[model samples]
Target chain A: MSVSDTHRTIDAIWRIESAKLIAVLTRIVRDIGLAEDLAHDALVIALEQWSQNGIPNNPGAWLMTTAKRRAIDLIRRNKLRDQKYSEVARNTDLYTEDDMDHNLDGEIGDDLLRLIFMTCHPVLPQEGRVALTLRLLCGLTTDEIARSFLAAEATIAQRIVRAKRTLRDRDIPFEVPAGEELSDRLSAVLEVIYLMFNEGYSATSGNQWIRPLICQEALRLGRVLAEIVPYEPEVHGLVALMEIQSSRFRTRVNSRGEPVLLMDQNRAEWDQLLIRRGLKALDRSQKLGRPFGPYSLQAAISACHAKAPTAPETDWIRIAALYEALSRVLPSPIVDLNRAVAVSMAFGPDFGLQIVDMLGNESSLKGYHLLPSVRGDLLVKLGRFDEARKEFEHAASMTRNERERELLLKRAAECNSAH
Target chain B: MRFMFIVKATGYSEAGGNYNQKYTDAMIAYKKSLAGAGVLVSAEALHPSSTGIRIMYPSDSEKPEILVGPFLADQELIAEYTLIDVDSEADALNWALRMPVPTGCGEFKIEVRKLKKNLGFLRYSGTCALEADLKDQLSMLKNF
Candidate 1:
């Protein structure tokens, strides 16, 4: 194979293997920073040696073996500097077993879960936890994480640095929080996954409207998370929400990659299989018999859309009620705006306009482009062409997505010509 | 019309020193109000002037000059800014007047400047087609 071809193969392999390698190493090393270094060291070795020796048939095992050797070397060399070495090293049977590979595979889920919990440790800042988790657990580079979050690379890099240091200095255990602590930590983990999915669903700031790769990674993570913690209703709720939302990924953007608004999208293009899976997950969450949390409520909202044959046929009344419930539980102006949309569809533009108009002075919505967009839609429905034109133009300016801006501008122009 | 509210730096802010929690709280509250009103366009807090750099082009085109700060005009340096589109200059001024003292010091100053109009000067041909091509190129590059 050509050198570039070898490098490409190695890159793909690393993405699949690196997370498992780091999770397993973090289990042994008990230090995220050190575990990451060891995993990186193994990757450097793979890049150097794989080109010469040809790619190994058992590449994961090869990386694992290489990383474990490095761990042993690190423990010996930095035995004095590293407190973790002293703690885990004293236990001779920790990583030196002949059946270490089998053992690592056996406890891989636990290690991955532990890694998730550790990376999302509550002590670290929210953004930091997310940055670190994406870096280690999802095999995302700092640049990818920054782009996904619509943040600067330097900011993400610093957050990761601070997170790893906090993990070490605070001696945050490399295990899932137990008892009362478990649910709180779990929420943060779920949040990180959801954040990743949201970025994919509707990119916050980018030329492209949807980032399917990010959504796919998030869905994979959520599925893995669901497998690890089957009893958690919220986990199922979150998974259901992502599945249903992701079902429309193909329809969300047109052949030209322009965004298709929910009401305008071709319903036939929505993925039925994913919708079924999402409904099943929602049912599982409901069967748990707990009060519906934010995720399940949102999933319920999405399920309403999935069941509808057409946008006009959608159960807007039920969605409005769900958003009302969501506002009571997870109150935010965004929810209020969404509820306004549902209310407008279910009842009339006037009813929704009242709610939206009340939020005119809402401080949180000032920089929010969607508020103007939603208002513009309502105004158009109300036959206020001039007002609608202004709102659309305002929204177009606020939007960072190039296609979204273009669509908004098109709407503004249409309103202008009509007026 | 859109106006830019420039927050002038003070001696306290330029030293890279920490401020009281209430100072940050007030700033957050101010930003929240701007966002809530549906008038705010964009906002950002600039880093200390020490980290800033300026490139000066020579008239003769022999060479460009690069200048790094701590620029001597520390007091004149911008600490932050917010852009807002309001109905009138008076409306913009009202919002600017309502802005909280950034450092909780009684003597904070903010300057609001109206942006130059884009309509007259930006009548370029094939702008949409060019922008579309550029957008495709950018999206393609983003995957890396």
Candidate 2:
């Protein structure tokens, strides 16, 4: 292969193996920042050597061995600097090459999980956690994470640097939390992953409709998480939710880049393979014999739509029930608003209007555009066209997204013409 | 991006001979790993070409030509395919490289091809448009 081709191959191998390499390194060195540096050193060496010697037969193992050697060297050099280094040096001597290989194969899953927990520790700010998780666990460059989230590269770089420092200063243990702490930490980890997925699934404010790469990265992380923590229902639930939502990417927007309502999306164009994987994940979550969590509930709601042959054939009653359950578990006005939509479809406009009108007094949803947008749809269904037009106009004014505002305004115009 | 790993048919596959137990187990393990990683979209093994048919549209004639298979050239045929959605072509290639080669089969090859997106939109546009129209009418009726 050419030099550039070799570089590309090494890049791919690095993306696949870096997280595992760093995870194992962190376990050995007991410092995330140091682990990452050691992994990078190994990568740099591979780039230099692989181009000349050709790629190794097992690139991952090669990278691991190289990083471990770097870890041992760093400890040896710093042996007098700190007691921790001396201890790590002593531990390192117990492992020969064969033991290192066995440890990598056997302990990688647990080490990776620990790395995720450390990155997503609740002690750090949410943005810090997100930046660090993508940087360390997802093998994303700081520039890529910045571009994906529409942040300044320097800001992302600073965020990651600070996050790593905080991880070191806080002296977070490089192990999964036990018992009561486990659930909270795991949720924190899941939240960071889901937040990454949402930021990609929907551009909250920008002209861009979707940042697919971010969603793909998030989904990949979730899948990996599910594999490592197979018994965790919520992990599978989150994966299911992301997979099902991702399946709708194609029909979620028009060719002109306007927002397309879920009901209006072309069901035939939905990715069946993703839908199948999503449903399988949901099944796995259910089969774990635990009560459904918020993500699983949402996945169930999406699955209702996925299973429908057409919009009119959708099981809105079941969806309404799911939303009711979701509202109970999650207790957000947003869930209630979604429940109203399902109720309107399952029952009638009047019943939905009652619930939505009750929500109008909600303090949390005061400036939420979707509230008015959904209210407008129910009003239109009730033949209250003038009121519907005003609601749509209000929703249009409240929305920040250019495409969403255009869609709401179009709905308002349609209501005007209907009257 | 989505990629299709086209597992090209071998002489043994074309002859409809079953894979050895070892190869079958290895293939299963490979697919399990793919699914575990969440990159796997779909995987399917095709029946031998003898069970299939090929259709050809001739430019000169109003009628299309149909050929019954037991097609020639086993190497050109696909015996199985696995679809995956990954971040890049490199990632797809990495996954393709990990696919288990059938033991005892001569000259195993898996071709990786990136699938073009939005092709389905063109194919289903007419039906989707009709569905939208039908939905409009139904909503109108409900409103009245």
Candidate 3:
């Protein structure tokens, strides 16, 4: 492979393995900041070596052992504070090459959980916690996070810096909170995971439609959370949601990264195992005998799609009813918008339009592109080609994303060409 | 993130007629989902633009001018709107993409734009004017 190819390979590996590497190092260094630095050092070494030596068979193990050794070196060279020395020494003795290879190859979830709680400690503000969690847990670069939220890069950078400093200065314990505190902090934790998964499933604005790496990280976090808090229905709900969503990851975008509507996507590409797992998780949520929450409701909706043999066979009525329940439980314009879709599918385009017409003056949706896109679809159904073309044109102009824009413009062209 | 879904007014809608049950049931369900998500901040349908008044602020600002509706209504259509709080633009887009058609006649348009939330910096300064001016930019007045 070329040097650039190797570099790209190394970058992909780093995104996948950096969380575990930093989590393990933080346990040894007892400082999140220092742990990240050590992990970066290991990554730098990997770039230098992998470019020359070709990629390793077990790149994650290579990275972990290297980082651990660097922790030992920093301690040996007195670069680290004296307080961290004994812990580093303990880590050095315990994480022999073979041991680290075994651990990274197996049970690194515990470290990941501790890392999550530590980053999300109530000490930091909620935004700080979110920013830090994405940075540490998902291994997203600051640029990526800022782009994801449409926030200034400087703003994101400042938030991350302050978050890390607060965590270090406060000397936050690197362990999961218990009891009442656990439930309180757990929501924040879940939000972060959900955001990460969404970022992976459908990037906000980027060249690619999805970033599978981030989604996998979130799924991992969700799964681990479900394991630790088996009784928590929400955790299972989130896991099920992510699992189901991810089953469609392969079919979400085309080779050129264009968006594909669910009905138009190749369902055969869906991962059956994941769909089964998601259904099982849903069953667990139902068995809990509690009313469905937001996540569970969405999972239930996705289940409808998964169970369908084809797009036309999807149970739009059941999905519509579930959406009704979800809206009653927690109402929002977006939920209402989705409900409009369910209603349309269960009923007809005209019915959906009536649902959507009331929202024409929705202040929040005034600038939203999909609103126009959907309206255009309805117009086409009504055979108002010129007006449909205009709506599609309007939607095409509103989006900052290229793939979505292309899709909208293509729709506009179809409307223009319609008889 | 916060976004507003705007439905543009068309001449046909201004005639003032009740939408059918298909539209009604779908809309009811749609609104319910928004409520269920707990992200529906506000939603309201504008009376056909003819029922509205336009106030224009000129550069000289000698006096605020007012004009009546249905003047070039074809050119200016602000029909109805719904606001929501979702995870990101992508989430808002997904929700928007799934919305039922909103017009009984020909075509309708709904536009979405992000709403500026009270960022940490903005909250500290409490400056709403600057916030409005900087709404679409990357300058976030957020603090940790």
* Model 3: per-residue Cα lDDT over A214-328, one tens digit each: 5677897788778767777878888998898888877867877765666667889999999999999988888888888877887898899889887778787898798788778
Cα lDDT, model 2, residue A329: 84
lDDT of 2 by residue, A1-419 (tens): 99999999988998999999899899889999889999999999999999999997778878888898889888888888888787877876444555656776558999999999999999887777888899899899988988887765655675676677778888988999999989988988988888788767665233465546778999999999999999999999999988998898888778778767666788899999999999999999999999899889988988987898976788878988998898898887667776776787788878888999999997878998877877888888888999999999999999899987998899899987895
Per-candidate TM vs. native?
A: 0.63, 0.69, 0.52
**How well is each residue in A96-202 modelled by candidate 1, as lDDT tens digits?**
33565667644887889999998888887666666787888889888887776565565566567767876888988888788998988898898877866765666
Question: What level of docking quality does candidate 3 show?
Answer: incorrect
Report how closely model 1 matches the true complex, as a DockQ value: 0.03
Ordered by TM-score, highest first, the candidates read 2, 1, 3
Cα error of candidate 2 at position B6, Å: 61
DockQ (CA atoms), all models: 0.03, 0.01, 0.01
- Could you tell me how far off, in angstroms, the CA of residue A74 lies in candidate 2 after the best superposition? 1.8
Q: Of the candidates shown, which would achieve the greatest DockQ relative to the real structure?
A: 1
Among all windows of 10 consecutive residues in model 1 chain A, the one with the lowest summed lDDT is: A203-212
Runs in model 1 lying further than 4 Å from the true structure: A1-4, A80-84, A92-106, A146-155, A204-212, A255-258, A340-344, A347-419, B1-144
Q: Given candidate 1, what's the lDDT at residue B134?
A: 26
Please give the CA lDDT of all the candidate structures: 0.77, 0.81, 0.74
